[model samples]
Target: MSLLEIEDLRVTFATEAGPVEAVRGVSFSLSRERLGIVGESGSGKTMTGRSVLRLIRAPGRIEARRMSFDGIDLARIPEREMRALRGRRIAMVMQDPKYSLNPVMRVGRQLTEGLRLRDGMSARAARAKALEALEAVQIRDPERVLEAYPHELSGGMGQRVMIAMMLIPEPDLLIADEPTSALDVTVQAEVLRILDGLVRERGMGLMFISHDLNLVSRFCDRVLVMYRGRIVEEIEANRLSQAQHPYTRGLLNCLPTIGGPRQPLPTLTRDAAWLE
Candidate 1:
């Protein structure tokens, strides 16, 4: 069964000029697989993911004909019910770990607090669970990490901690929004490996949101390209280079070739009526 189902989902912001449609009729389903959503800023990729969790702020309104996860209707669920569903059944890993982690609290307490909230775990049980989560994310000296403050950890280490905290709930679906964007290349690769491992081992559904086309093509099973508030193309990861849309083709060509001829890359030109 599909772990998530979204149909005709739309999000609009009440701007001063008028209603700005951020997401227009975007829909997709995910199972035990990695689904990549890629686009430049203002392309509606992140908004779609946020709308799924009803995370859109007050000025932004989300409307969907149907939105579901695990056969439960998310759009119809109450705020309290949605809260219950969020951390326990579905989890999100935001772009920056520094912003997500509390600076004042010790890492161990903050990490275990997630488990306590969703699962009502005892302090002892939460600690054990936190340790296990840290181990799964390949953090060395999990006990030491637990005792350190967020400021004491490196960017990679902080991201690993965030992943551990989110995974402690054993959520069925994981939405990672540009999870490695703030890190260096090496750290990005490491973070992806940890995410890949968890998704593969647990057979969990993953919605990986990013603008890194090359990485998305390699790591995900299927890739969805967004432009101007719509999905412009969808293709298997292996077939990304063969995508038919002009936008998709341009994106693939724009990627810098490693150790190959070094030259200025051509930028993408937009067309407003291509989808028509």
Candidate 2:
């Protein structure tokens, strides 16, 4: 069964120029597997992920025929009820940890805040859980990390802490929006390994939003190619090279291969018909 489902999801913003649709009529379902959404900036990949959690606010609005998670209707749920589900059931890791983590707060306080406030965990127990979560992500010095502030850690360490924070709740579905975009190749691989192991062991669904086609093809089970706010094609990750859509083909062709060519990478040609 699907852990999350969406049909005709639309995200719009009120602009002086009129209404701008950031995510237009996109739909998909996710089981307990890694599903990747790949697209260039402005293709609505991040918007779609945020819409599932009802994170859009103010000038932005979300509308959908159906959006549900674990048999619960996300669209119809009260904000109070949604708040209860946010971390405990569905968690999201933002692209940058510097902005996401409170700069003034210690890592331990941030990690244990949700548990103590929402789950009513004792301070001692929450600290222990936080340490375990850090260890799971391969942070060798968990105690030092818990005491340090966000700025005290490196990009890779901060990202790992974000993952650990989300995993502490043992959420059923995790939406990671460019979680490793800022990390170096070595750290990126380590983060992916940690995420893969956690998802497999816990049987949690993952919506991995990224623009790296090569990485998505290798890491995810299924791939959704988005173009101009719509899914242009869906294909098995292993067979992405054989995708039938011209947009998907164009994207694959644009990837720069090592030792393949010395010339500049080819530019992606856009087609208006692909938006239809």
Candidate 3:
């Protein structure tokens, strides 16, 4: 059975103009594999990830014909049960760690809090686990990092620390929403490497949300190209070069070629028919 199954998922927000459909009739299934959701901003990739965890607030509502994680029916589950599932069974690594981490709290305390509360571990044990998780993400000087405040860390270090905190609970699935977007190219590679290694070793399902088509194609097993709040194309990562959808092709063509002739990046031309 699939680790996650979402069918006819729709997210809507109440606006002065009318109800805006942010995610429209999306359907997909994932197992213990990487599934990439890629699109331009406001295409609803992030909303889709948030909806999986029931993170949508008032004035915004999620409706779906079916949504399940493992054998649990997420659509029908109680909030209490869903809370237990979150962070313990399914965790999300947000796009920006600066916003995710608490400025006043020390990094080690934040990491240990979840372990102690969720796993019923002693403070000493939780700290040990926190340090181990830091090392697992290839963070050098885990002890030093643990003691530092979130504001003291660089963008890359902050991101790694976020990843470490999320992984400390040993979740079955991870929703990484552009986890490397705020980092340098080199740091991006390092973060991806750590995520790739963890997914492989742990056999965890990953819902990787990103705008970078090339990165998704390289890192994911399957790709879903969303446009205007709907999935316009679904392609195997290995077959991304042969994507048939115009939106997917347009995105791919926009990527600059290294050491190639200089040219203006292609602008994406939208078709109204795609919304239907």
Q: Tell me the TM-score of each prediction against the true structure.
A: 0.96, 0.98, 0.98
Tell me the alpha-carbon RMSD of every candidate: 1.3, 1.0, 1.0
What does candidate 3's lDDT look like per residue over 120-159, in tens digits?
A: 8998999899999999998899999999999999999999
Q: How well does model 1 score by local distance difference test?
A: 0.91
TM-score for candidate 1, please give it: 0.96
lDDT, each prediction: 0.91, 0.94, 0.94
Query: Comparing candidate 1 with candidate 2, which one achieves the higher TM-score?
Result: 2
- Ten consecutive residues with minimal summed lDDT in candidate 1? 267-276
Query: Which portions of model 2 show Cα errors greater than 4 Å?
Result: none
Q: What are the runs in model 1 whose C-alpha is more than 4 Å off?
A: none
**Number of backbone clashes in candidate 1:** 0
How does candidate 2 fare on TM-score?
A: 0.98
lDDT of 1 by residue, 1-276 (tens): 688989988999998999999999998889889999999899999999988789999799999998989989999989999998787789999999899999999999998786687568899999998899999999989999999999999999999999998888789999999999999999999999999999999998999999999999999999999998899889999998789998988988877777966778877887877545
lDDT by residue (218-241, candidate 2, tens digit) is: 999999999889999999999988
lDDT of 3 at 70: 90
Models sorted by lDDT, best on top: 3, 2, 1
